[model samples]
Target: MKNELWQLSACELAEGIREKQFSAEEVIYSVISRIDEHNPRLNAIVADYREEALIAAREADRAISSGEKTGELHGVPVTIKTNVDVEGKPTPNGLPAFEDLIAPADAPVVRNLKKSGAIIIGRTNTPELSMRFTTDNPLHGRTENPWNEEASPGGSSGGASSAAAAGFGPIHHGNDIAGSLRCPSFCCGLATVKPTFGRVPAWLPSATAERGMLAQMISVQGAICREVRDVRLATRIMAHADPRDPFWMPVPFEGWPEMPEPVRIGVTTESYDHPIHPDIVESIERAADYLSDAGYAVERVATPSVNEAAESWLRYVGNEIKTYLMPVAMEHGSETIQQIFEWFFQIGGVSDAEDYREGIKERTSMTREWNLFLEKYPLILSPYLMQPVGAWDSDTKNIEELRKFLNSGIYSLCVS
Candidate 1:
């Protein structure tokens, strides 16, 4: 039982627990110790649940001793983003005003994780209302990037990314709508996938009303992990059936058969007139090369207009945000979040009612073009961030900085 158990992936931990090489309690202790050592400075796991996790771990060990069947993630310690419901825990969503709004039940993904025998060690931080690109809120403070304190950990799932990178646990729960999951993973140098909408069920027991249509379509639950295999494992576990969400499909995790050999991958470095950093371009090229070397027929091919899709996302989803989320930001958000919202409104002008309808019509056409293109190229390698990671507070300093920040992630907001 070494402290290095915290470094094991979810798959390795589960295997070790099943083989009786280590008790589930030992793994939980190791991860909790790691969190205790680093989370004070990182502020990654904002709410500690180590005691409950230990109890769950002991139960998992007993289940093994009894020769009971176990789930795929048995005994693995993980963290949930603060915005998601975890029965009886407060889902403040980085707003102090909602600090007392405890969830009556676990969100769908949380329940699925528990069913997979994953033990929740803590809850991670998020931006105010989970809207910003960095994880800093008046409620829980900021989550620092483990690699560089000054650089962002990426938000609004920065806390999850930070915790994963810090070795607090192997798998962390995160949701993305416009890069919440992807951006944080990119910043913290972790692995994640913004699962296609409907791939995983989602619902918040604490929500007073449903989210906007765009939010419902774009937002998805995902896992942030140190390894890609763990991302797949956690995502598969989280994707288990949950009847609460109508979008939850019964499709198998590996629904599609294996693709033909030499899969054709489309590589695009198009910056849409924005000045992309050389390092970013180099990274994209390097990845493309790796894919090509791995026997994939990689080619630099342009599909539909990403710029147009991004613009539509900015104007349409932006308006949806203004219509649904702006009131909450106005009423409960901090001054910084409020100002950022205003700047977002300025950069992506809110559409009038007629324009909103038009945007939906335009979105359908855009989706069709992408679907048709995907039939030719199943995978596309595109830039996540056009520049290197920015400072933690770059998006909130002023409107210009925020605009620059958004411009750097033009690909992140769209292409869902």
Candidate 2:
């Protein structure tokens, strides 16, 4: 029973602890044993907090014994992505040069998780500067996919996904700027939701400066888990209000009134010049069928232009990266990372200063179009990546391959 504890979902663990079926210490030790067995090979967790975690678990057990009120995630173990703050821990973000940059306080997501009684067992790995889609960095090395070592676990939340799939923990905190959360989940066969923008509060106390405007809008914090229920639970916990992030919304998670009978679901398979993998098309069709069977009004239809939005993302974000982040990358980033940044510029096409302002303005129009479409069809079912998952290093191999990889993610980056 102790050994099997590591295999349970966060939901299961929380219930078990709440019911006194098992002490939090027992569950933590089970997960620690699992990590000891697998982490050396996978390198998913860069910083293990075994001693600290055990202490926390014991405290949680004591609180339960005292019959105190418990939080939603009481005693469930989770891993925080190294990019975010964990108070007193270094948020290296997979960069070696900033190894000493310790955080003074927990980021809002971490605070929420802790407040909900979740214990952090470790900090997960990420690519240098959390820029790449594949997880490898000078700070913590590469995190291997548990299913296929040669395959990518996905980045910049690759470490979180790998750890979650390997049973290091049930909930792994991750943030998505350009599909960082979903891409890793997709690669690792896990479940995650890139919560609507402003749904989850975000802030890094150790950051030297704020991110660019576009990045602030697109990037969001979330969790990856083995079960959709765990994902939903973690997402709700992470959405708790934080005074630090002014963008955080106070909206309820599930209080919306029921839609008219046969809720509309707009389905699209538009690949737009990129080869749409047959498996992806079949997946979409199957999902639409399932929704229809479940009483949804699923319709095959053309929606707004994902390609145009994707292009806008590239141009606007590429220019911001060039202006704001390139200098830092040049100063502290590895050569491989620098080369990848060059390819990003090549594929994304940096906009001039004049065009950059105009593009920012154009974003409003693009968002308006998507919002209007969503008003008619409350839900959209579309292919996230047109092609099947590629090799871990496919994006860094050459310019052409990189472009193909970026093009494949048109739906993902554009939807954000």
Candidate 3:
């Protein structure tokens, strides 16, 4: 029964708890045990309150026994990235300087997760500021991949991905700017989607959102999971209209596609000139081939680049992010963002009228380019990374490369 419990989906686990097939305590303990066995090796969890988790599990059980409608995640253990706020937990966002900075309140995403009946089991590690794709922070050290501890688990979301892949949780909340979520999912062999931008609200008290060229780009907060159904479930749980977020667009919660068991899929191991690992290319093709055999259109082709999406991400996020680095910069800290800031600082943090016009011109061209592509393919299959995961040490090896994005920070943490 214990082994069987490990195989259950998020929904299945909830049902078991609800039906008294097993108590919430049973479920939580099983998960906690898994975390104990695996997380130490993976080093994914930086801070944990297992005793608190058990108490929360009891409350969830009581709520169920009292006949109140239990939340979707009642008794389900979920790991929050250290970057996100969780009451007493300091949302360091991978920064050592802010390790003592506790959030007075839960971030909206956390509030929503709790409202939906999920248990906050632990906090995961992340690269400083979650700036890189590989997860390693000065405060919490690196999170190793489950498949190969020597390799990366991918950054920012790396700890989350590691936990999820190793069965730490059925679903994990994740954020993305430069592929923090998607890259790790690719490497870890899971499914994650970064919805059209602004779909997920972003509000961290200490953190600022990027501005300017990134205004139209999406900086969504969503979930990662082993099953597709869990993805949709967690998304619904978190996608409420937050008027506080100027960018939140209301998407239909009820009539999402209930397509056949197999949906039409467009698969590609290539996108632009960025080469993906041969094994990954083969894996994607094999998955596509299997899907094709399962009756889905598994065609290989070039995917549309969201024009200005990356640039827009930089700009919009930059607008807010530039400020995050300012205090640190003034103190001559953060060797990572310093060089990039150097270029911006030279311009005196002010774009000339001509520069503003040129930035706008580039955005228009990029948006136009993206729309042309998404128009054809509603769902795309593309490579998640260029190479296999390497030691977490690689990220800090050449601190200069962090600025260049040559070594994807926690964003590329994966099984490869």
Candidate 4:
């Protein structure tokens, strides 16, 4: 019996399948079975194509046996956020009116993943238009956190984070505009990386709005992984320039050295006036101190001002998501969607166009400041949140609390 059913990383499984210690089909089957065993309870995976996945796995095994060379991720199982397309699957983004819509073609990221030999097993749920953090929408209901079931796994990439954290896959593809990748990893104690903007391709059909300035800054497609090595792996595999996204640079992925040298490390204990909870504060201190102990020069600094950029970023992002919901609001005449749009427009309108421009200036200044700081400091160790992971309380029972919970993570992480 080839007992390959458990928490092995992608590399491990790929090696196992290559050596014939186990079949890629076996791994896909095991993952599907495990997800089926848990998904109904958590409501994480909204639409699963287990049969297709298993068949693909079998084909992968046959190809390997035929001595055909496969990409780096050959025969590995993985899942994607529902916001992106998968050819035949629906890219719902959690809108009920749009459930029938299907992608005629795969998003560039999906194409690369398949080309790299990753097996597509499932498409996970996301908040409506992946707007807010917690994974809840009309289409998929809600996706519970795997750790402390009551707590949020963090979103809009919440499902991807939960699946990866729960051992559903070695790597779950996700995107980040505001801490979507990093916040969940913080909540789950998983390692995540937010690559510089345009390092990864993003060509989703559901996106009907222009990229705005976020095209240049503050948006990235990164990974949440258990090992730093996987961060490097995903970057190497997916960071290649996709001309589809003209923003992507025609540059090769820069590989990290065998050992990153101990350099100047900047530490920010309080990025905002937001008090860091003791447990989280201690965690930050420990991380900062570790770098110091490792012989890196540590410098304490005040949190950089992110308020202006945050306001602009929120308005632009909120408007984009609301625009995505506009068609739904029209078809179903949804009170929720309409009201959300009204509120979004109200706030966005209040910002004079020049105010938006000023915010961009603020963002540019901050980025330059960070760049200058990094010029001397090779690394910056900072907190992903103001608090520790707490179980979600069902009693909260209101969208207001959910709103607060969703914004708190970004408020905590933004200043630096």
Candidate 5:
């Protein structure tokens, strides 16, 4: 059981612990040992908490023995991405200058995870300021994909994805402003949901200022997991109320009424001429087929042009990045990251102040179109990445590669 404990999902681990099939200490030991064995080469988890985790596991076991109530994630080990605040730990966000900038307190996501009885096993890596699509930085080096050493694990939350795939733990915390959560999940063949904005409370205790409007509206905290059940469980825990985040919504995690009989699902393989791979198209079709076979009324339908939304995102968010975040990148980020930022600006083409205001006004129309479409078809099955995952450093090679990388994820950016 010790040897195979790391392979279990969060739900399974919690149930086993509750049933006294395995002590929390045994589970922690197994996961920590697995991390110790493989983490050196992967560099997925930069801030290991093995000693502290073992102690917490022992306490969890004691509580269980005493017949105390346990949270849904009790005894399950999880990793926090380095970008989020973890009390007393450095939230470098892969920047060397901020490598020693310790967090004043846990972010809402961390607090909620702790309250849910999840053990913090380690802190995963991210790209500098968590801006890029690939995970590599001077502070944490790089997090390689377990499936292929040369391929990217997926950016921003790449470390979280790598850790999950390599069997470090059952759940890993991550955030998605654009593709941070879904990209890594796609690359690692895991499960995740970039929850609707305001679903999961989020805040950085060490932050000195507020984020841009687009950042505040779009960014969301979430979890990456090997199983969809674990994703569902972890997301509910993370969605717990927090006063620190003003945007956090009061929403129930489950118990929603079922959809009408024969739920209709919108299916689209429209690439907007972005050069989607045939394999990717086939995958979407196969998934639509599966859903249809499962009693869904799947139909090919056109909603809104994702390309237009994506372009708007680039113009609006790109300008915000230049105005608010570019200074930090220019001053402290590495040459590689700086170059990537340039490519982002060049491709997105920053909008002027008036144009930005108009774009914001126009964004609502786009959202309305999607909402109306969704009201008719409850679910939409579409391609995440238009093509397969690329090499780890493909984005940094040159402008052409960077544009292609961003282009591949148009669907993800459009939603964000």
Candidate 6:
């Protein structure tokens, strides 16, 4: 029973705890034991907080015993990605130079999770500056995929994905900028949702300055979990309003009036210049078939210009990186990461100052096009990455490989 406790979902554990079938301590112990046994090889968790988590669990159990009101995630163990602020912990984001940059307060998502009764078991790893498509850093080293060491677990949230897949906890807090949440989940066979921007509040209290305009628009906070229900639960909890984040919306998670009986779903398998894997095409088809059988009106049709949107993402974000992040990377980042950033500039087509300003305005028009398209279809079934998961070092091999990788994820980068 103790061993099997590690397999329970967040919902199951919470229900059991509330019903007095299991204590939060039992769940925490089980998860810590799992981490102790498996994390050495996986390197998913960068900072272990087993002692802190156990104490929190005890407090949570006492609260329930005293008949105090509890939040949705009462006594549940979760891991936070190292990139975000966790108050007093370092948000290194995989760079050794920033190891001592301790957070002054919890990020909005972390605060929301704690308010919901979630305990942080540990902080997970990420690539240097959380920029790459795979997780590896000079500070914490590489996070190995639980299934295969050679395959990437996915990044910038690869550590979160690895922990989720390896059963370290039911919920793993991860943020997405460019496929960080979705890519890792895809590689690790977990479920996740890259919540629409402003749906979840985000603010890194440790940061010395504000992020670039494009960064604020594209990046979003979310989670990865083993079960869809847990993803839904975690996302809702994380989406709770925090006064720190001005972008947060006071919208309900559910209760959107039901769409007509058969919901319209637009399905696209278009890969543009890149050759999409056959399995991906087949998987999309199978999903469409299943949706159709489930009474969704599935149609294989093109939507907005993904290529153009992707180009815009590259242009706008590339210029921002060049202006803002490049200096930091050059000074404190690894030689490999420095080279990777160069490749990014090459393929991203960094725009001039005038073009960058124009690109920012152009984003509104692009978003309008997508919003209009989404009105008719309501849902779009599209590939997150054109190909299956690649090797850990696939993107770092050469400029061409990195370019291909960026191209494959056009949908992910653009859609967000």
Per-residue error at 3 for model 5, in Å? 1.3
Question: Which RMSD does model 2 reach against the true structure?
Answer: 1.0
TM-score of every candidate: 0.98, 0.98, 0.83, 0.88, 0.99, 0.98
Q: Which ten residues in a row are the worst by lDDT in model 2?
A: 254-263
Candidate 3: regions farther than 4 A off: 3-7, 206-216, 256-275, 297-357, 399-416
Model 6 agreement with the true structure over 165-283: per-residue lDDT tens digits: 99998999998888899999999999999998899999989888899988998899999999999999999999999999888889888887667867899999988878799999999
Q: Higher lDDT: candidate 1 or 3?
A: 1
Model 3 agreement with the true structure over 1-416: per-residue lDDT tens digits: 86446557788888888887887787778888888888878987788878998999899889888998877778887778787778767877776678788887777778888887888888877776666667765577778888887777876699888888898878888887667778678657787877667666656654555433343354567787888888878787777666666777777777745555455566655433444457867877787777788777666665544322444334434444465555664463366545445543332244455655665676667667656664554456655555666666565555444433432222222111
For all candidates in order, the CA lDDT equals 0.91, 0.92, 0.68, 0.69, 0.92, 0.92
| Residue 208, model 6: Cα distance from true site in angstroms | 0.7
lDDT of 6 at 113: 94
Tens digits of per-residue lDDT, candidate 1, 1-416, equal: 46799999998999999999999999999998898899999999999998899999999999999999999989999999999999999999999999999999999999999998999999999999999889999999989999999999999899999999999989999999999999999999999999988989999999999998888988999999999999999998898888999988888888676778778899999999987999988999999999888899999998788778877888888888888888998899888888888889899888888998999999999888888998889999999989899999898788899888888888987665
Superposed by TM-score, candidate 3 places the C-alpha of residue 193 at a distance from the truth, in angstroms, of 1.4
Prediction-by-prediction clash tally: 0, 0, 34, 2, 0, 0
Tens digits of per-residue lDDT, candidate 4, 231-301, equal 67866677765667777776667655343565677776654454467876688789877878889888886
Model 5 regions more than 4 Å off: none
| lDDT digits (tens) for residues 229-327 of candidate 5 | 999999999999999999999988789557887999999888888899999999999999899899999999986889999989988999889998889
RMSD of each: 1.1, 1.0, 4.7, 3.3, 0.9, 1.0
Q: Which structure is stronger by lDDT: 4 or 5?
A: 5
After superposition on all CA atoms, how large is the RMSD of candidate 6? Answer: 1.0
